[model samples]
Target: MSKTDHPHTHQTHAAIIKRLKRAEGHLRSIVAMIENERACVDIAQQLHAVEKAVCQAKRTLIQDHIDHCLEDSVGALGRGERVPLDEFKQITKYL
Candidate 1:
């Protein structure tokens, strides 16, 4: 399966990347806003939106890894494959 299918690891990386690029643009706008002395609440709201987007992307990636990669590996191990245990252990760090 594809990386995005991994649920926890999987994400539309390209999509998230594009989104992050947009966020960067938003950051530049925020910077401009600061230079222009925009209202604190407006800046804060923009910042919060950026944060939310990033967190959402992260969550999507994590879910992809879990759903696809981890689930498949776990299933394989259950079927008597000897791999995936270490990977499973490694994933715990993210927890």
Candidate 2:
């Protein structure tokens, strides 16, 4: 489903996008460093930073989806309704 169709909005969408962009820039710099024959330690450090940023962005997005979309969807269910255990397990895999 599209973001607009989700029951809850992502408050960190903008921040996530910003983080991804920064990661993208970092990746480009790493590529340039490789072409310029930069020191291995410097390249590794930059690569590490890029990986960490991308990881953080992914984590933030997943947490936002769980906290908002999943919670909101389940909260809307009628009193007698039940969410499948398998579905809960599936969602938790992202965490």
| TM-scores of all candidate predictions against the true structure | 0.67, 0.74
Count of clashing pairs, candidate 2: 0
Each prediction's whole-model lDDT (CA): 0.75, 0.77
Best by lDDT: 2
lDDT of 2 by residue, 1-95 (tens): 74234354478989999999999998999999999999999999999999899889888977777766666456645444445333555667866
Q: Write the per-residue lDDT of candidate 1 for residues 42-91, one digit (tens) a residue.
A: 99999998887787877766666666677778888899875566666666
Total backbone collisions for each predicted model: 16, 0
Top TM-score: which candidate number?
A: 2
Off by over 4 Å in 2: 1-9, 76-88
**For model 2, the run of ten residues with the poorest summed lDDT:** 78-87
